[model samples]
Target chain A: MISDITLGQFFPGFSPIHKLDPRTKIILTTLFIIEVFLADTPLLLALMLLTTVIMIGVSRISFAVVLRGIKPIFFIIIFTAFFNIFMTKGQGEPLVHFKIITIYKEGIIRAVFMGLRVIILILGTSILLTYTTSPISLTDGLEILFKPLKKIGIPVHLFSMMMTIALRFIPTLIEETEKIMNAQKSRGADFSQGGLIKRVKALIPILVPLLVSSFKRAEELATAMEARCYRGDKNRTKLVKLTYKPLDFLWFAMAVLLFGGIIALRILPGHISPDSLIYDILFYKV
Target chain B: MKEIIKTKDLCFSYFEYSDNDNVNQAKIDVHALVDINLTVNEGEYLAILGHNGSGKSTLAKLLNLILTPQRGNIFIDGQDITKPDLTEDELFDVRRKVGMVFQNPDNQLVATIVEEDVAFGPENLGLPREEIRRRVNFALNTVGMSEYSGHAPHKLSGGQKQRVAIAGVLAMKPKVIIFDESTAMLDPRGRKEVVDIMEKLNREESITIINITHYMEEAARADRVIVINDGKLIMDGTAKEVFSHVDELHSIGLESPQGRELINELNKAGLNIDTDALNEDECTEAILNKLKAI
Candidate 1:
């Protein structure tokens, strides 16, 4: 049951999106996330959705897999949408009148918009960043991106090294956890047949051994790393260097175009606005 | 042969606190390694055999500079690494020269991918990108893991993971590689695979090998075997010389290889058979020859 998590899962592929440099994918993912927030009108959100769909298609990741990525956060998404629906104040009559709650037209629109925004946010980042780029490359890109922070004495390399090590050990630790759980089960420890507090108490047996083993592993790993001459990014070199290809530049150009379109939709005059006409006709019937 | 690693009366102790809550508890010094003098020549296959907590691992750590000696000096390639004023760069250089493969394959790897972990040591050395690439490829190929380069480390078997760990050390191009009970967690097949690599590295690549293990068969395969008992070097000799003393090995909580044990058993049964055979093949041949003579 603990192994169902698909977070940070990379899908190996030979698509154009996968071929782009990890740094490019990371930057573009950030831009797309910002664009998701900047998208105010239905037309703009539709454009964002179109971009996300195109990306997922290009990466050859099935829609089913992308939907599964959203499954773990499905409850949070529903809570957010419902909270916005009930609590948001609008400039119109109530769409639904309950005894203690009133739902407005704007609130419904806002909730739908927010939900779509979050869905697109998850899909866009997962497709461009996590799905296409391997975890090592992703961390490598992050380390390079945050290199300038080293001047502020932030220990960027240490953090990335920690991240890489954590990623490397996640599977190992999970396997260890499973082994401990099975061992406890064989000793007649019941994990499933308990109340909330009892269940949490039951976990102590598993957690204690897991923690002890983790500390042991950490000490051994430190010695092993020391034996390998690892000294925390002091004059360290990379075997797989991150370099920009022509495809990256092309991706950058496309991102710039998207940014410009978002800006134009936000600041352009009402009559000349491409999204405004659609917004007016869709929401208020000009 | 030129000595690549030499330790002069090296000593190390771990201070165990009596009680964490007590402010004035007396700390007990657990001597992990006590005065020992040893020399590892270039391209030598030296096996350290000991029972658990016998200071063999402590000796391995001291050689790799993971643990600083409390009282003695370690000279690697004619340079003293235990100097009090040794710079960090100098320490790293010495560490790079002395690579170590640890017991657990799961803990040692720093990268998610096999190739990246192999590249880790070279990357730490700050080698050129091309040089790192070349070394990583060469290391993987040398370990026969070239195809599994792109594979995730945790998905690999224990033997494969240990090989990748060796490849990780090999990429650094160290003069000496120490296996600190590296095959302890592996199955017999995995143990054979790692021991074979140690032999190959010592024989073909001319890299000095210091394998710390409790396995008698593994010790028999090494050119020289040193037995550590209770933080002291109890026995150091050629494999044949060491394994022939079956009673001494048994007294120190170690067993001679099956071959030696069988010969001893045959000798006890009133058969005059040579007890010098250190491995099964030699023991079997010696028995056959004795039987034919009879």
Candidate 2:
């Protein structure tokens, strides 16, 4: 059953984070992700972690949720750490120098910081955007944000329109797929009892009908759209306006201030990027 | 009575490859409708009676301008649909006057949320945000779906989905609505809910309703009925005038409604009963009158 998929899941609540406008959340989430990677020093990474903790508190989402968003692609984080620990060669005190593979102190620090960077990025995004904002609002926010692309002949409304239709039909198509599968299974088609190849072969019965039904649905939807006088033009108006209220401005301001604080740290008289900072803290002889 | 929808000598045929949905299947020329000259007055409820492949749906689509007639023109609110120079915006204006509620509820609705789906038509009309909201609210309340405005479409039952679809079309404030067998896919309760809504719209709101269906009982309830068989309009009259010819209806693969059958049978048996009785109470009254006279 594909029903258990909690991807792009929004936890409905009345918390401050949930109350923020979706556009504000999307912009700030983008800023937070950029800051997560730009946070070079261990102290900056610590600050990003602190911001994540505070936002999570405001969001009212549990710690399990923050981890759950990263659970699927967590291997990528581990792989990045491994890559940094093994390949990040620098003249520093060896943390683990077994034979020719000299794992330096700088490598260990960078690897740890890189892992933290990924976890912080994933947590901040999932919490602020996907967890707090509903998918429909999120889509509206994206369409509004990308409205400028229309000037470049990108057909911005068309893309967002497609996204909206896709999001609307996902559950419908899934339900139809399940019905088709059940119909096929009732006819003595064994899906679970087959080997890999045979299982794939058994899926043809379900897939063909599902495809046919989806195409039929697509046609009907097109007719419905046409009947409603959908002009497929830029002059069309929306029901819900993406208005930035006082709460949105407040959230936007906080994100800017946090971003400014990180930039100030980077441009400080003796400050360096995180990669260099890690090198100095680990390998630079005092 | 001003005609809200008029189709003059309308003819339409579906090619095997005309629509992409039927691609890769066996292809044959399907003559859906032929030479259908019908006029629907404003605020009147007209039912198109037919079995499957009987061209009633083809007529419904032509009325809404969803499928243009291949041989004739449809006039909606006095706009000719077959105008050679008709702009796309003008076509939309025609569709605006003649809205349609299709058979499958899941297929007709485009939005995930119920209110958003209801607001779809107004939004497409380029109305202001507040106006769209107002229409959405009003339409949902009319259909008794106000409680489910925030609910997802896929989560709703067949009846609720059909109601939402109706609200979506009703939000456009169309003068006429064509139900293309809208209740065909619903259960008995869902079918009753849709019929009640159709009756309400026709009686209270004074909107023109063209319901296409094979169900004889529903057709009996309409103000007027037109029977289409083999792409030809064979019979057209009020329910009393029409159901009196039960043999002709049965000849075209349609049975008279239960009450119509009882009254027609009694008349055939030489009992002096009115064959115009459409419901159980009326049929019983006719029988009682005949027995009292005896």
Candidate 3:
């Protein structure tokens, strides 16, 4: 049951996107997510979607797998589209009206654009970052990016250790949870046939044991870490240092150019920002 | 022999909270180790054997200064970590000299990647970047896990993960490594993998080994064996000398090796055979010689 959720899963590949330094991939993914938010029209959203498809192509990972990783985004897209369809006040007459509901011509366009923006945002990040980069290197990239936080009195080394340990335990803890749930199910515990509150109440059997075992494992891990001479955030050296190669700079520069292009397209004629819709209704002549 | 580790009348106690009828009176003093005078020589593979709750792990913790003795001083390479005047740096130096590998490989590894986990110890030591790489490579090579350096640690087998944990300690290049039941949770194959690595480290690297275990077979192969019972050292000698006391071992709920048990049965059955054989091969040969004499 837990295996079906593919978030944060990596696809092993030998393509250029997969070969990019994790730091480069991480920074580019952030830029792409921001570009997705800047998208206002169908054309720009289509452009962002095209960039994600190109990244998926470069990675050689199957489109189906990358799409499966962002399955939760479909729900968000639908919910947001409906929200805009109802809440977005239109400029013209309503096409359909009920007792307290009105669907306007402008609302339909706004809903379509908003839904595309969200879907493109999810696709852009999942394909470019999580699908291609392994979790180990992702942690490494985070450690590198977090080094500046050390100067602000934050324990970046400890934070990275925490992240590494957390990632390492995800599978183990999931397996443990599955085992506990199975044990309870075998003992005639009705986890499925219950009301909402009843279902949560039925999980007490599993939760109690899981919490106990987690604490036990946590204590043992702490003792083991101490035995390994883990001095938190002190003078430390890493084996896999984050060194940018020529390829990383090339990819990073290309991503920057693409981001600039996104901003330029956002400012062109016929590209509408949601701000203009509200501006015509407030403090401006329609 | 240079005494690399010496414990002089070491005593340790910690407060343990056990669920009981009297909740307020639950803070009980648990004596994990008491009055333990022990010496571990340089470059020796010594095994400490005991049953559960017999203070085996507590001794391992004290040897590495993870748990300090409340009543005595533990001298690691002639530096007493329990000295009141010692600074934090001095304690850190003592801990650096004694590396440790634990029972659960999953709990001990601090990184997601095999090589990154192995490099964690040296990384903590503040070594140079190039030196860290060299040590990681050498450690992985020594453990026969160089090829698994880039793989995720959880993807490896139990034995492989344990080997990676050993590499983590080896990267630090400590003079001594104490295994506190490191093979207890592994299957037979994983156990064999770790034991072979420990033996190789002891023989090829001249590293002092303190193997705390419950497995009699592991202890029988060691150069020396020490028996701990009720938080006190009961017997310490060569393996042959310690295994000779079969009845005493049985009284403490510890097993003798199969050969030792067979020889003891021969001696008990009114047969005039020496009960000194420590392994199956030796016992078989001794029985053949006895038959030939008959």
Candidate 4:
């Protein structure tokens, strides 16, 4: 069960996007968010979509994988769109103007745009970072970025060690959870056949064992760490240091161009946002 | 006659359940180890014999500094392990000096690959990469697991995994190694393989070995045998001396070797049979001698 649910949701591939350094990918994801929010026109939004599509293409990961990544957040998307449609007030006409219930044209337009932006943001991130970079490489990039903190006595090696350990145990704990669930099921604990509260109560047997085993594992790991003479935070070195290659630079340059172009298109004249265009084309079709 | 490890009047107890905020507090006093005093000499192979629930594991934990003695001091190469000046960093020094191989090879193994796991201890020491690689290779070679360096530990047999675990500890270059029931989970072939490796490491490297085990035959391989029952040391001597008193051992719920058991029965039946066959081959020869006499 834990193995099936991918936590990082990273798709392993050999595409250009996968070859990019995780720090570069992480920075690019942040930049994409900024560009998405700054986009004021439908044309700029279309450019953002184009950039996402290109990223998806270069990643060579299937579009269905990215869609699967967004499955969990679909409810959040709908809820945000619903709130945007009903909450905002605007001048002029209303699409559904009932007693104290006014859904304005502008509100509908903003809702559609906001919903699209959220989806686009999720899509861009899944394709760029999660679907491409391995978690070890991601932590390696983080350790390199945080290496300067070592001078301030921040224990970067230790932090990276903790990250490595956490990543290592993610699959282990997931496997443990599956085993516990199976054990509980064999003992006639009906987790699948009960109401919400009853199901939760039935989970206690599994949870208790899981918690105990995890605590035991943690204790053993601590002992093992100490046995290796791990004295926190001083005179530590890594076997694998993060290195930036030409591919990372190329990917970085592409992201910058895409972001700058999106911003320029947003500021240009006579360009309409996707929401307003959709509402105008749909609502004003009299 | 160099001493690798010495414990002075060691005693330890576990008290749990007082932490619960119940109105009526209860104390579950578990006397895990009591009044244990022993010394392991340099390059000596020693085995501790005990059944389950015995204090052998507790003693192993104490040696590695996992459990602090509630009563006495344990000195590793003349350095007191329980000293206050010895911080956790210093305790690691002690650990490096005295490597430990746990019972469950699965739980103790931290890495996915065999070579990586072997390198774990040396890497944690912050050794140079080349040195780490060299040590990893040497340790794997010592355990006859050099060919398995690339395989996943999970894919290996119980014996192979245990050997990998031994290799991991061996990479630390510890002067002394404590195998705490490591071969208990292995099959007969695997058990013999582990025993042979332990003997080789002891003989070639001159490393002190403290093997905790339940098998009397394995204990017979040791130069000295220590038996514990109900958290106290009941007997400590050479294999011949310790295994001589079959009735005393049986009274303590300890099982002797099948050869020893047969000799005891023959003696009780008024047969003039010797009772000191340590191994099956010796027992076979001894039985043949008794048949010739008859």
Ranked by TM-score from best down, the candidates are 1, 2, 3, 4
CA lDDT of A120 in candidate 1?
Answer: 91
- The superposed Cα distance between candidate 3 and the true structure at residue A57, in angstroms, equals 2.8
Model 1, range B196-289, lDDT digits (tens) per residue? 9999898889999999998889989999999998899888999989987778888988998877888898899999795577778888999999
Candidates in order, TM-scores: namely 0.92, 0.92, 0.90, 0.82
> Residues A21-43, candidate 1, lDDT per residue (tens digit)?
98898889889989998887787
Tell me how candidate 4 scores on lDDT.
0.81
What fraction of the reference structure's interface contacts does model 1 contain?
0.97
A best-first ranking of the candidates according to their lDDT comes to 1, 2, 3, 4
Clashing residue pairs, backbone N/CA/C < 3 A, model 2: A40-A274
Model 4 chain B — which ten-residue stretch has the worst lDDT? Answer: B104-113
Candidate 2 lDDT by residue in tens digits, B1-294: 898778888889987654555656657787888888888889999998988889887777777677777898888887787878988788888888889998889888888789998988988899888889999999999899999999999889999999999999999999998898999999999999999999999888899988888778888889999889999999899977888777888888888888768777777788757547886788788788889989
Stretches of candidate 4 above 4 Å error? A1-7, A83-109, A147-163, A174-184, A263-286, B8-37, B52-54, B70-73, B78-84, B87-89, B111-117, B140-161, B184-196, B230-234, B266-275, B280-294
Cα lDDT computed for each candidate against the true fold? 0.89, 0.85, 0.83, 0.81
Complex DockQ per candidate: 0.85, 0.71, 0.67, 0.27
Chain A alone, TM-score per model: 0.87, 0.90, 0.82, 0.84
Which sections of candidate 3 miss by over 4 Å?
A1-7, A41-43, A86-103, A181-202, A265-286, B17-27
Model 2 lDDT tens row, A1-286 = 8754644788889999998888888889889989987788766788899999899999889988678778888899989999898998778577777887889877887888888888888888888988989888888898889888888889878877888899888888888878888888788788888589999998888888888888998999899899888877535778877788899888888888999988886666255554675645633321
Interface Cα RMSD for all candidates?
0.7, 1.2, 1.1, 2.4
* lDDT for each residue of candidate 4 in B164-203, tens digit (9 for 90 to 100): 9889899999999889888988899889988998999999
Which regions of candidate 1 are displaced past 4 Å? A1-4, A72-107, A270-279, A282-286, B17-25
